[model samples]
Target: MRARLMEATVELLVERGFAGTTTTLVSERAGVSRGAQLHHFPTKNALVVAAVEHLTERRGEELSRAVDALPAGGNRTRAVVAMLGDHFASPVFAAALELWVAARTDEALLAAVAPLEQRVGREAHRMTAAALGADESRPGVRELVQATLDLVRGLGLASTISDDSTRRRRILGEWADVLDREMARA
Candidate 1:
């Protein structure tokens, strides 16, 4: 029941920004009774915030699982970049974006999300470094990893506005090349 409501909330958040995803809409979409929904999440903020956290955790786990499938040699750098890009461009990311945008102006939402965002950011960095075989103890490696994450996040934002697959692919390829060179230097 909790999972259903959270999943529905994430879907609605992606389809219709934060302002449009209401508790009533979520209940109907989840096919859960209003009483049950309210019992689980008493307020809209409570429901949406919990939903965003749930999706964020799921997205991170999915990325971690997919990392195992990444190519071990050859254009592995490119593969890693592509994998990270795809993860950021997923629907769950979009839903998180909606929550982030709303949280910027809503104190209550911000209070709930700021810590989660920080944790997610740290985990993403850790995972990206691990996937790329990057050792941050070396000079410049930490910055390089951060740059890769920032670049992919920007790509994700661009994707939300339009169909950016072609351009994003090209950019990721170029970035992969640069990352390979930089990582080698570091």
Candidate 2:
């Protein structure tokens, strides 16, 4: 029942933005009684948080697998591009986009998301820093990855909302350039 509701919420988040995704819609789409949904999540935010948590865990696992599968000297650029490709093409990211907008006005949503964002950001920075042979303790490594992540995410948003495949390819190309430069330096 919990998974059903969460799945429904994710679908609705894609269909309707966060402002429009109500518990009522989730319950209806899940084909479950409202009472069942309320039993698991008293508030819509609880469900959103749960869905986001699930996504974060799944994304982490996917990233770990990708990193493990990469060749030595590592082709970090291609790995990053592939990860971004999969991420941007996913409907789940549409749900995340909705949650991001909602978090601006909802304190509870922000609270739930902040820690997950920090964890993911740290992991991303660690990957970039390790690839570049930079110390993880340094701010420069983290800042660079942060900028890269933002660029990729922005391109993802553009793809999702505007169907901009060219923009997506451009973003991937840009990452490749950065990676080439960094790997050269390394």
TM-score per candidate, in order?
0.97, 0.80
The candidate that wins on TM-score is: 1
TM-score for candidate 2: 0.80
Every model's Cα RMSD, please?
Answer: 0.9, 2.8
Q: Best candidate, lDDT-wise? A: 1
RMSD of 1: 0.9
Clashing pairs in 1: none
Off by over 4 Å in 1: none
Off by over 4 Å in 2: 73-76, 127-139
Alpha-carbon lDDT of model 1: 0.91
lDDT of 2: 0.72
> What range of 10 consecutive residues in model 2 has the weakest lDDT sum?
131-140
**Residue 9 accuracy (lDDT) in model 2:** 87
